[model samples]
Target: MNLFHFSDEGSIDVFLPRVKENRKELPPVVWAIDEEHEFTFFFPRSCPRIVYTRSDEMSDEDRRAFFGATQANIVVTVETGWYERIKRSTVYRYRMPAETFELFDTIAGYYISPRTIVPLAVEPYGNLIDRLIARGVEVRFTPNLHPLREAILNSTLTDFGIHKFDNAARA
Candidate 1:
């Protein structure tokens, strides 16, 4: 089973709805927003998967609640459409090598899963890809555009994998 990690949150929303409308078959795909400084997991059940304000910025009780809510094995994080408009037009032309890899490694360690799919905008370089392969990380290449349909249709988790979070983990 493959873990599909999308670097772009905007595309995820687009793809998810499309999948529902078209009734496409897919594998178990988990999404994590690869942002500049943090890896945010989106929970379909929760209202907000991530807070723009840091934990330190929140009160002790709120911090505890935030961490408490994050205990879910999977989550849904949806970014605002307004921010996506700005990001796509001006801020997306340039790519940072180190920051992108950091995001990948962070998600790998946190999720502790073998497979992950990230957007082409922040895809790892050739050398980093080699390192990931060496470490037994199966990184799948996904398209950068409106690839929601293709991604969901071709996901490994949906095809051959199962989501064991509720039954096994909750037990």
Candidate 2:
């Protein structure tokens, strides 16, 4: 399977292993996502968002409550303020050879390499929001993600990611 790294900047030539400020408990490593879950990064970095999908453990009641009749298996939600930025944003997808990376988070599709690496190629994706919708992702915009976050955390929507949520608007 192909692996990729997405960034707002496009001039990256080398990816060095570095610990993220927010995730100090983990060792320094270069992060990449597999092609199947690339949709997870289809937004401006630091955009406080939540993405989730139906999991085998999820009850039918929860599935119907969260995904009504939507055909999209994946659902992503961001605060209302990020809407305009999402519409105008452009992200660069850096393709990486998966040989040097090891599976880090299986459910998240994350792979990590302890050593530095070079991207095979970089491709630009503009009209970020449009691209996400085109890929069959149900996109949502809410004024405050606090309630949703609490709901998902308390519920069975376990196959999910809440990225940069510390930056989300307070309730």
Candidate 3:
């Protein structure tokens, strides 16, 4: 599981064992910590990365910086799988309530998804992507580049026919 601090300076050492030993995936839990304990949760790229927060509220600049830092820390050579995962699960929790809608709009504005399926149209689906795209979140979408686009294009043109979109609306 990835622990996000959402900070530019702080660090946490997440326990990520080698795949050969442990066959468990990381748990998803967001831990908000006070500055009382010594930070033992720091690790290199070989381990899972944790994102820490610098202040009580995250500003637009902070959000952009945090995304950049995470991308830099978690470096992967491949892209396809990751991109698909993002498209499937791009939801994120934000600090401010009003900004949630704003974030969703931004995500839709940025990534040009060939998949006409508007994720934002779903509940909380559009929130994270919108914020990320609006603030210029630098997530690598190499997996979603060509093949996915082609599949989407082919699907839209011939597979489902022209009325499938309308049919889906009624359902």
Candidate 4:
């Protein structure tokens, strides 16, 4: 399967994992939809947030309020057979698009889109790349720098500097 990740230009050549030493607290291994959507969903610690109509309806103020001050980043694509395996092994919770919502059950972590699945904890993601590599995954990077020149320029998370990884690089 082809999975997509978005990140800043500086990280185009690197894959940064949420390691205990660097993060102190564990974080999820996140990815975005390969295709575009009017709204992009994020589950930062099981609290769902949406970056809605970033290129259209949303105002700059709302963008900053909802997504913070950030610019476009690179998009990463990886081909792996692990998505299903990971999804199946992990327990997930999801939500639909709405203007506002309150968080429930703090431990599940957040997931966007009606059925977007995510693991309950960050532990499995700790060695996600390793598992992907063990399963023979191929990772590739695509830079989303030029707003007028790239397809991903319109992606909701483009300005958020999302990052993706290629396990092959480690080998």
Best by TM-score: 2
lDDT of each: 0.27, 0.91, 0.26, 0.29
Better of 1 and 2 by TM-score: 2
Q: Each model's TM-score, in the order given?
A: 0.19, 0.96, 0.22, 0.20
Candidate 3 residues lying further than 4 Å off, grouped into runs, are 1-30, 33-78, 90-127, 142-171
lDDT tens per residue, model 2, 1-171: 899999999999999999988779989999999998998898898899999997789988889887888877899999999999888989999999899999988889999998899999999988888878888899989999998899889888879889999899988
Which has the better TM-score: candidate 1, or candidate 4?
Answer: 4
lDDT of 4 by residue, 1-171 (tens): 122332212123323333323234545323223223211211112211212223444456545643344342221242233333333442222222222222321222222222333322221122333433443332222222222222334533334322222222222
**What is candidate 1's CA lDDT for residue 16?**
23
List candidate 2 segments past 4 Å from native: none
Clashes by residue pair, model 2: none
Candidate 1, position 75, lDDT: 23
Residue-level lDDT of model 3, residues 94-119, one tens digit each, is: 11112112111221121111111211
Question: Which candidate, 2 or 4, would have the higher TM-score against the true structure?
Answer: 2
Candidate 3 vs candidate 4: the lDDT winner is: 4
Residues 130-151, candidate 1: write the lDDT tens digits: 3333443232322221232233
Name the candidate that leads on lDDT.
2
- By the lDDT metric, which is better: model 2 or model 3? 2
